[model samples]
Target: MDRTVEHYERIAATYNEHWTYNPDYVRGFSHAITDALRLTASDAIADIGCGTGLYTRRLYEDVRPTRPILCVDPVRAMLDQIPASPGLQPLLAEAEDLASGRVALPDGGPLDAILLKESIHHMPDRRATFDGLAGLLSGHGRVLIVMLPKSIQHPLFAEAHERFEQLQPDPTEIADMVAAAGLRSSVSYRTFHAAVERERYVHMLESRYMSVLGEFSEDELRAGIDQFRHSYRDTPLLRFDDHFAFVKGWVPAR
Candidate 1:
């Protein structure tokens, strides 16, 4: 398994314990998905990397789609967090599963809205994966990929910061990939101002909340957090913008 996926797999059960999203931040992101996808009551939705269905459930409520929503993820444990319910179907698979025809949506039709929230960077074959998605879109459908810019603003331990920049792709390049797949693509930005207790934020680091943090050894992570504490001791409340690059792709009107 890919290390990123492995990271999630190991942390699946306690996923919610690692971090807490500001309720306002979640609301903003949910709104961004609805607005960018221009979702409708009848749109069949698919959340490709719907970990624990945290946002998926919220999104389901906001869109209130009449068609069944497919919540797909590679980790079975993470998928299990989403309870079986009316209008929701959980699929244990990766993006490649859909692209390679190994799996099919329960409804067996093109999707009207596709979401890849915080998970686009995990795909090994971006071009091929997106080409498949473009082909799967209904005429009026849209795929909204939520990713961070290659560079980010969140304060991190020095080495962790450098490692994150190394790993994260430039969101602009992803937009280009979407265009190359023959879809009309546009990029937008969203920012969530987070104010959290400094120690609470540090615990998120120790939990390896960010995948890049997983690359660090236990001792290294301990040391890194120690350094962060020493440097940020005076910062009782850590304030930063949780930034997002919203990349939206759609089949243009014929």
Candidate 2:
């Protein structure tokens, strides 16, 4: 398994803990996508790289309660956390496998939507992956790729922000990739706030809650945490601007 998958498998148990700090962040994103797609209870959806079913559960509960949804991820441990439900199906697979027909829709039909919620950055090849996934969409199916651009005006911390900027794909590049895959594409932005106590935020940082933070050495992680604590010493209720780029692509019915 790749380092990314291994890292997530190791942290699968605590992955859902993110909701505690920013309860509405993921749900807000889900609502935006569902609204943009005009999804209904009958629409078939897939949540790619759905770590611990964070957005998966929210999409089911808040948006499409009876929709057939597949939660796809490479790590079994992560998939193991998803609660069993009639409409929710958890599959162990990677993004590249989707295009190969290795990953199938829950109802054995074409999908109406595929969601890559903060998960595209982890894919090995963005262009090829998008091209492959586009083929799996139904005549009117859509794909929504959500990410945070490096140019975000504000992030949780300077170091983490810089790392995100370096790792995330450019919005234009993502749009081009989707368009190249023969789907009509557009990009939009959304902003949410991650509210947490300063002490809790520091603890999350120290634990390397995000995969991006895993790149830092122990010393670097410690230094970053110290800087954050020092910077927000006076702010008890710490709120950070969480900016996201939503890239939507769709093929018109034949």
Candidate 3:
């Protein structure tokens, strides 16, 4: 197994631990999804790839009581950490497993809104993943995909995409896959701001990024990560408003 993948799998527990408790990231992400989808009281939503249920609690708050929301992820450790709620249910499944019919809702229904926040890039096959998502959609279901574009050129974005490209997928490729999934899709561009002191932004970038750099012994990678960290440490708080985009689509009713 690739050490990076194994590392992520092992750190899944840690990711859950930190992310689930972070309110700022969760609220911002949920608001992004809700805004993009124009979520209504009648919507039955499923947050696909809901790691650690970071945004699931927000989903519970933002979505209406009349609508049932399902949280799905393949990582049990991540899902298990989430406390249960009245309308919230967690399914242990991958993005490609959405249509596997492994998870059944109490009401025997399909999803009206599906949120793929920051998780779409992890799928081995974007096209297959969309197909699975389409299969699980209710007639009026909309799938909202939050993607961080590759050309952003920020150090963290660039480093992440360099490794991601080796996996052979890009946001544009995902948009194309969404079209091919036989859904009507459109994209909205938006920005997310990080409110941090200049030094805090640097620390945030370095501390989080170094974890990934540990995988490589290449002096260039090491140097690049460090240089990026130094250049941004006192520069300014990162706006992150550039790399964010969302694609919303609907599966035709059967």
Q: Best candidate per lDDT, number? A: 1
Instruction: Please list the residue runs of candidate 2 whose C-alpha ends up more than 4 Å from where it truly belongs after superposition.
Output: 65-67, 153-155
Q: Which residues of candidate 1, in runs, are more than 4 Å off?
A: 18-21
Per-residue alpha-carbon lDDT of candidate 3 for residues 162-231, written as tens digits (9 for 90 to 100): 7644543466667778888889877777775544455554444444432344455556555655766676
TM-score of 2: 0.92
lDDT by residue (1-254, candidate 2, tens digit) is 69898778777887777565566677786788787666778778888888888777878886655665889989999999999887688988898988767766556768888888878888888778878889888888988888877677442578878887788789889889999999999998888777777677676776677788888888988888878778888998776677788889999656
What does each candidate score in C-alpha RMSD? 1.4, 1.9, 3.9
- Is candidate 1 or 2 superior in lDDT? 1
lDDT of each: 0.85, 0.80, 0.66
Clashing pairs in 2: 150-165
User: What is the TM-score ranking, best to worst?
Assistant: 1, 2, 3
Best-fitting candidate, measured by TM-score? Answer: 1
Candidate ranking (lDDT, best to worst):
1, 2, 3
* TM-scores of the candidates in the order shown: 0.95, 0.92, 0.77
Q: Which ten residues in a row have the lowest lDDT in candidate 2?
A: 148-157
lDDT of 1 by residue, 14-64 (tens): 776544457777776788788888888889899999998878877888888
Candidate 3 lDDT trough over 10 residues, lowest sum: 204-213
